[model samples]
Target: MATLLFHLGRASFRFRWFVVLLWVAVLGAAGFAASKAPTPADEGFTMPGIESQKAFDLMEERFPGAAADGASARIVFIAPRGEKVTAAGNKAVVERLVHSAADGSQVASAVDPFQAKAVSEDGTTAYATVSFAATADDLTDASKSHLETALDKARDAGLTVEVGGDALATKPSAGGAAEAIGIAIAAVVLLVTFGSLAAAGLPLLTAIIGVGISMTGILALSEAFGLSANTGTLATMLGLACGIDYALFVVSRYREERAKGRDPWEAAGLAAGTAGSAVVFAGLTVVIALAGLWVVGIPMLTKMGLAAAGAVLVGVLICLTLVPALLGFWPNAVLSRGARRNSRRHRRKQLRTENGGSRWAKLVVRHPLPVLLLGVVGLGAMATPVLDLQLGMPGDEAKATSTTERRAYDALAEGFGPGFNGPLSIVVDAKGAADPKAAVATVSKEIAATDGVVSVSPARFNQAGDTAVFSATPSTAPTDTRTQDLVKTIRDERADIESRSGVSYEVTGRTALNIDIAEKVQASLLPYLAVVVGLAIVLLLLVFRSLLVPLKAAFGFLLSVLAALGAVVAVFQQGHGAELLGVESTGPIMSMMPIFLVGIVFGLAMDYEVFLVSRMREAYVHGDAPKQAIVSGFRHSARVVVAAALIMIAVFSGFIGAGESMIKMIGFGLAIAVLFDAFVVRMAIVPAILALLGHKAWSLPRWLDFMLPDIDVEGEKLNRKREVAERVPEPVG
Candidate 1:
């Protein structure tokens, strides 16, 4: 692998212009394809093989044009404290708003609150449902504007009005000022690390170009592949972070080679062969971890995982080819001025001085047991909160109170009950029953008597009268545990109901769908972790050629991941310090958050592991003592790892500024995970553990070692070949 990469790097340097132009052409083609592709569809929430999904599919089949894919809005109106919406004046305002809303572009119909019996028992609040002909994503801006105008008229009449539904949900934009801020911080970190503007800017430039290509390609193929609208988000975040880090590693290695008196061209090849090998392995681990999301059997998550894996693959390719080619353009500019001007004797003298990383490594080595204990105990304490973790799909209640959606949700909850915001749809299949109408009525009566059910609407049958649908409102909030139990209770009692009424029923709706999704995701988490972690362990064994090292790395990853989850639970779920982070409301954590955090954090955790541990392995292979190898690795690679981790943290933390609760949770979780993994686990715990184990840390069974392929990830073969060539006497001409 090292030899192959060495040759490829040199060729790219020799043919720099060709490589550069090729990438530019690819970028342009991707842009053109994206421009011509159709807009992505807004598919409704679907969980195939689940009861809720089965109910939804049956509804779509039985009732044409009544699929859940269409957009809908519930405009809630609240009269003055002393006045009832039933009063003549307040009633007039409500009727006018409904009429105006019905006239809006794309509106199918707007129900009158009085006729629909949507008015609250108190007579002070009412809500009208506005149905749209198109899905939320397909709704025109003009239609949204028309609805907004109608809302203003209602407010003008001294009534408090708020609209909530899928129609008003906007797609969150990426690459906003927050991302810009992250990139700026990354640039500054690079500048300080490299001490050369040219060197620092190169990584950022390559990363942006790579991310642009991946994002455009995702956009171009989204419609054809049925990717969700937010598929590009994970791709963008991983692409930029990994691209910069990969390039940074290669460039840092190239400068180190140059400092050793190698020519510019040879330095680039050596850098690619050495650091590039690690990059390939690191990139593969990330790809494997991400792509493993497919095992969970969620289509949206699968698309997101594959898209992000592709982005990481692009970063690896650019690091191997484009980085070397670009290095050929200005070989001397990348080197620090101090290094370029220093004499060989002075350079050697400077290298002998102890650096901070070396001192830290030495201190840990001196007190390995103490350091290990402190790190483990500290992280374990942080991970305690994870035991109480709760998973759910947070709804409008999780949104900021300032959003109309949240306000509307609150108003409805207050007017009726918490469950009014998440009514469950019950579908009855009475096609083979002796009397369909009697069976439907019996089923509705049974459902209304369920413990948690507050009310059941009249059954609305299909044209053939074989299928019927009704709504059952629970007494708890959408995300409440009681609501989930209510859904399960109805399903559990279905057998008895069917035996009595001769009709089969299924429960579905936004609430039930969310419940099912959360259950599925939770069940899949362990399997997903097993697949990702087991595969990564094998990959690490191949790279490091050690059994204990891979196990240690995996264990460290578990600690960091758990700690990160614990932190997320405390802040986002338990509401501790949520106000400081802009969390307006607190509830259960997003169902898929733990899986995402584990997969992504595991991949990035391996990145630091490979970079830091490979250097130590290289030193050990070259005959350094175990303790000395630890110091050598820290001295050479510590600075780059620190800078890369900071860049990743900055990029992720920037997303905290987004308005979307899901995005904010993702960003915050990723940032904290990276912090724990990079600093506490990799930097501190790893070194201490290695020091405690000493030579045993790198040991592999002889038979197993013989079975495993030697990929030479540490570039031992390349260094040996170079040494042999230099030792050979030149032939006289």
Candidate 2:
């Protein structure tokens, strides 16, 4: 593998222009393909066999138009402060807006709120409903424009009109601003680390190119795969960070070789054979972790995992091929001019015999017990919040105040009740009943009498008169625990309705569906955790060929992941510092966040584990005491880990500005995880554990050793040649 990679690197160097132009062409083609791709409708995050899915499917089968296929918006008109909304004026505004919106191609019908008594007691507020024939995601930009225009028509005469709900929700910001911010921060870090504009720029350029290709692929695949539109932003986050980090590792190694008086092509070949190998293994770990999301069998998560894994794989490819090609174009100036002058003066100066990381490792070696205990206690403190972490979708309460969704949500809550924004749908299958309408009416009255119910609509039967639907509003906010309890209450009340009225009841609506999703996701957490953690352990065991090493690494990784999630729980769930990011209050963590974080953070944790441990293992294999190897290995690899972690943090943090609160949570969670894992777990915990374990950390039983295949991630042959060359002195000179 080393020989093949060496030859590949030389070939790329010899044909650098072709390599560069080929990537350019591929990127252009990807963009064109993405531009031509179709968009998916608003698909629920559902698993086929789950109860929530069963309910949704039954609802759609019995009542197709009112189920998951339709989009509804609430248009609220409130009189300005100190003004009253006259009945006639409110009627005129609602009628005009409804008529205008109903004329849109996408709109199916617009209901006058006045007719339904959707007006506040003080006559200060009124709201109308606009229903779309298609799902929210199916509405085109033109449809939105028309609706906005209609909404604005009611804004005159001291009326403050706003639109909200599935149809009028704001799309996430374009993400360009976030990407730019991340790239700029990365450039500063790279410039400081390399002290060469050209060298620093290479990683950024590689990242952009890689992310461009990956996002294009994600967008192009969305239509066929039913991927969420948010997949592109998520893919971009991972792709750009990994792309830059991969190239940075390879390029850093190449520059080190150049400093040793090796020719550019030789340096490129050696770097490709060594650091390039580590990049491959590390990237594969990430891909494996991401792909494992498919095991959960949720379509949205499955597609997101596949798309993100593809992006990371692209990063690996660019690092292996494109990075060296670009490096070939600027060999001598890869480092600062000052560093080059210093290298010339100390041509025979061997590399560092001791560094800061090694000195820190020595301290750990002396007090491993205390260091390990401290590390555990600190991580445990951070992870305490996970115990209280709630899992559900963030609602309008978490949105920016400037958004129409938030404004409308507030207005509706003030006018009617919090649950007015997310009414529950009661679908009754009444085929078996002698009189279907009577059965539905009996169930509706019974449901309206249930505690916590604010109101229930009269039953509306389908054309067949076999399926009857009622909209029920609760008194609490949709995301509130009380509201979720109301859904359970209604579902549990189905038995009584079936017995008394001979009708089967099912709760199906956005809020009810979200509750079901949250419950199922929580239930699946343990199995998913087992799968991801088991995979990481087994893969690391194969790579390192040491039982204790993989175990130690896995335990430390779990700690880091827990601590990262705890940080998110603090900010987004516990409401600490959430206001800094425009979040007004605490809420449930998004259902998929924990699963996604577990997968992503586990891979990233293993990335540092592989890079740091590979260096230590290489030293130990060649000839060094375990303690010495730990110190030496950590000294050499710490800088790269820190650099990569910083770059990832910057990239992930940039997405906090995204329009969706869920994306913000993901971005913040990932950034904190990287920061905690790289700096705290990798730097402090692993070294302390290794220091305590000593030789046993690398020991494998004879049978297992024989069965396991050797994976040389550091190009052992190259190290041997260098060692042999050093041993053979120049006698004549």
Best by lDDT: 1
Question: What's the CA error at residue 395 for candidate 2, in Å?
Answer: 2.2
Stretches > 4 Å off in candidate 1 = 170-176, 343-350, 731-733
Report the Cα lDDT for residue 719, model 1.
93
Error of 1 at 489 (Å): 1.4
Supply the global lDDT for candidate 2. 0.82
lDDT for 488 in candidate 1 is 94
lDDT of 1 at 76: 93
Clashing pairs in 1: none
> Candidates' TM-scores?
0.97, 0.92
How close is each model in CA RMSD to the real structure?
Answer: 1.7, 3.1
State the lDDT of candidate 2 residue by residue for 1-733, as single tens digits: 5556777777788789999999999899888988898764546556776555676777678776555547888888888786656657667767888889989998888888777777798888888889888877678989989998877777765479987878977776634598579867878988887888888889889988999999887777778777777666557767877788888888888887887778899889888888887888788888878888877777777778888899999998888889889888887677766666875544443455666778887888788889889989999999999999888877787787888888888988888878887788888888878998888888999999999998998777777889877899999988889998888888887887789998788887778878887888888778877787787778788777899988888788889899989999999988889888866667899988888788878777787888888889878887889889888887778777888888788877877878678878888898899888998889888988888888999899999999887666667876677668879988995
Best by TM-score: 1
lDDT of 1 by residue, 417-441 (tens): 9999899999999988999999999
- Predicted candidate 2: what Cα RMSD to the true structure? 3.1
Q: Return the TM-score for candidate 1, rounded to 2 decimals.
A: 0.97
